[model samples]
Target: MANQQVNRDFLFRRLHSLLGVVPITLFLFIHLTMNAFATKGADAFNAKAQTLESMPFLPVIEWVFIFLPLLYHGIYGMYVAYTSGYNGSKYSWGRNVMFTLQRVSGVVTFIFILYHLWTAKVLPDGPSFDMVQQILSNPLQYAFMIIGTVCAVFHLANGLWGFLIHWGVTVGPRAQRVSAYVLMLLFVVLSGVGVSALVAFHG
Candidate 1:
């Protein structure tokens, strides 16, 4: 009975840990796709953004759906990494590289997201489509945006790889080896599409 209880508790904890990733991953995919619309024109991007904002109880929904999930996922992911004896140097080269990339990119994405929200979503006198055009027209904004997009893509891909492992799909030596290359390739393609969209918007 004790052993069964322990197993149940362990399973619950793992599920709780995983719950953090799901909503955030979904939101990231949707957000990346929507932001891609910016490539078309300011009007297109604004229309999408405004439509989202105009939804009933949008402010409340944003807090529930976006902010809360992100906070939990980011914080819980870091906690899991810390507790799981995750050592970058001990893993295979590809695994180590991806692990490091994910950590660094996660931090970068968090910072960029915070800044984006502050400037684009929260501020009282924040910029409009014209202002965004002017800002993004600057070389600095362009560079920062490119870096942020790359970081976001890498983070998402890396998280997906980790999720697979957690769900028992990629176990042991051979599976880990294969997953690394696959995830890396996927990240490259995803980031390429994202960056292209941003560039097209600016052009």
Candidate 2:
């Protein structure tokens, strides 16, 4: 019985990690790339938004492929974060900081996602360049967005390194050290894209 419980927990955690990288992180990449069209100008951004809006079974797609997975990952991740300890006798300071930030950012990202869905996605008028521009134009709102975007991107990128280790993809100090650098670079790149897209709203 005890063994069974342990196995169940192990599987649950594995699923949580898998969902983070898959539909959740992948969706972030695609969503940010779409947003990047804003940098091209209003017309370009509007066209991209139109393309998305015109997709078939949009509600079904968002609920099944995006929201459900994200909801599970976020809720379960919060539980794990609450239960897990953040101390170690044999880890670098950078690694320790990442572990702590991972939990902190997870909570922040969940809140940000809720606010974002309400403000940008579920409103009556639908989303457009002008709508997003108006939304981001407020200085306080702009700062909040910048923080949310950075936290979300960092959560996704850093969660990826943990995903790899949990899945036994990076099995040793040497491999983890290398992957840490690579994933931090990934975090920077994704954050740049996210922040740039947000700022593009003002242009």
Candidate 3:
């Protein structure tokens, strides 16, 4: 019975990790890419946003593919963070620090997402170039966005690295190291894109 319980727990953890990489990560990439249109102009951004809003059953797609997975992953992650002890101080290793950051950022990103959804989606006005520009007009709001972007990007990129390791995809030391560099590059690019979109709104 104990063994069976352990197996179930392991399976749940694996699923949580897998979900981060699949629809969750894929959606983030798509979202950032779509928002990147803002850099071109408001018309470009609005057109992209309209394209998304025009999708049939958009709410259903969001709930199934994005929101549900995010909720599960965030809740489970918070549980893990609360239950787990931080050993980064003792280990003083990069991965150890990253593990700690992963937990911290997960919580921050979760809150950011909730607030963002409320402001952008829940309101009857809906998200638009003007709406985004207005929200980002406040300096504090701009700062919060920059911070949120960093947290979300780090969470996804580092989560990807953890996902690969946990799944035994890159177990060897050399392979793991290479994967680390690639993931770091991915983080930089994603952050750059996200921040640029936000900046475009600011200007």
Candidate 4:
């Protein structure tokens, strides 16, 4: 029974790590790229939005490729976070702090994604550049966007490194250290693009 439970835990952890890197991360990349179009001008953003909207079975694609996987990954991640203990205080290591921050960011990013989708996708106004600008006109909404973007970027970036470690892709300390730095650079670039697009709304 103990062996079975251990195997089950291992399986779930593997699934959680795999899902985070695959469809979930891919969706985030596409999403941030689309939002970065805002930096090109609202017309460009609107054009890209309309083009995406015009895709056949796009809602089905979203449900199958984005929403369902994201929901599973998020829920399982929350469970893992709940089960894990935060030892950053005791360990006082950079990786220990990042481990705690990754879980914290996961929770925040999950909530942010839910509210973001509800407002931008499920609302009667639909998802348009003008709609986003109008919604972001309020200072509170703007602040939320910034917080959400940063949390998401951090979560995904750090999660990428964790995924590699969990999957045994990066075992040695040197490999892990190099990957960590690369992923941090990735987070900065991704967040910079996202924040630039967010600020473009002020125009």
Candidate 3: regions farther than 4 A off: none
Judged by whole-model lDDT over C-alpha atoms, candidate 3 comes out at 0.91
Q: What is the C-alpha lDDT profile of model 3 across 1-203, one tens digit per residue?
A: 89999999998898899889888999999999888899999999999998998999988999999999999998998888898889998998998899899999999999999888887778747668999999899999899998998899999999999898998999999988898899989999999999999999988
Model 4 Cα lDDT, one tens digit per residue, 102-197? 999999999998999888878846577788888799899899999999999999999999888887999999999999999999999999988988
Estimate the TM-score for candidate 3.
Answer: 0.96
Order of the predicted models by lDDT, top scorer first: 3, 2, 4, 1
Candidate 1 lDDT over 26-137, as tens digits, reads: 7766776777777778888778877766689976877888897777656655554456544676676766766777777877887787776775667645334565556568
TM accuracy, model 2: 0.93
Poorest stretch of ten by lDDT in candidate 1: 124-133
C-alpha positional error of residue 94 in candidate 2 after TM-score superposition, expressed in Å: 1.8
Which RMSD values do the candidates have, in order? Answer: 3.9, 2.0, 1.2, 1.4
List the global CA lDDT of all models.
0.72, 0.90, 0.91, 0.90
**Can you write out model 2's per-residue Cα lDDT over 1-203, one digit (the tens) per residue?**
89999999888988999989888989999999999999999999999999998999999999988999999998998898899787744665878978888999999999989888988888848779999999889898888889999999999988999988998999999999898899999999999998999989977
Clashes of 1: 0
TM-score, cand. 4: 0.95
A best-first ranking of the candidates according to their TM-score comes to 3, 4, 2, 1
- Clash pairs (backbone) in predicted model 4: none
Spell out the clash pairs found in candidate 1: none
